[model samples]
Target: MASKMASCIFCKIIKGDIPCFKLYESDKTLAFLDINPLSRGHALVIPKFHGEKLADIPDDNLSEILPVVKKLVAATGATEYNILQNNGRGAHQEVDHVHFHMIPKPNAEEGLGIRWPQQKTDMDKIKALYEEIKARM
Candidate 1:
């Protein structure tokens, strides 16, 4: 069995140490409403198996969460939604446990509205980054 971080909040919720407004639970996964929700039905889908980053999770565990996200979007009458998962501090991942945010975008202006200020950079720099990442893979 894979090891789970004992102090992780998601692990605590899975262990029933903390209470949650539970939405769905399976033998290997759990879906619960986010306490600091972006919208009325903003939820978090997490694997019962604890992992700090997406790369740390097994494919089978990671694969099970999307359906739950869909289920929530439909139930909430969300016209659109954003499925976001962040890794590491640079990405603003407040929680160390790997989790996906299913933020329902009911309106265009509210609930985690995004403004991407696009910056044009040199193509050589971008190509170098791509090559560096490809080498690691």
Candidate 2:
């Protein structure tokens, strides 16, 4: 984990090794403007702890993330936005760090465009899967 943190860009930012357009910072989290933004006021929120995925982060470290994102939204005056978090390379997560994107959607052409491929649902399968997951939870 120490070695990974040393190489991680976000960790570098957190450690003050890399400069960022920092917006907010707390003991548990940090918020800053995205260098390569999808839209104006596009920003990122990250846990201070070095975790590659959401499930890897402690709940205490995650507590301030959403509130900080919310503050950024208000501060940026963004009326429409998408809060995005990807888990792995397969999920389009380029950085191997647990971070959330607050992408402002100014219009139809910009910011976190995605396709929702709706699949036909089988009720029995859905019920069975839900029951299985619920039991685990």
Best candidate, TM-score: 2
Candidate 1 positional error at 105, Å: 1.5
Assess each prediction's global lDDT (C-alpha) against the native.
0.87, 0.95
lDDT of 2 by residue, 1-137 (tens): 88998999999999899999999998889999999999999999999999999999989999999999999999999999999999999999999999999999999988889899999989999999999999999
- TM for candidate 2 is 0.98
**What tens-digit string does per-residue lDDT give for candidate 1 at 36-133?**
99888899999987778998899998777999888888877888889899899998798888898999877876577776999999999999999999
Best lDDT among the predictions, by candidate number = 2
Error of 2 at 7 (Å): 0.3
Q: Per-prediction TM-score, please?
A: 0.83, 0.98
Q: RMSD for all candidates, in order, please.
A: 2.7, 0.6
Residue 74 of model 2: what lDDT? 97
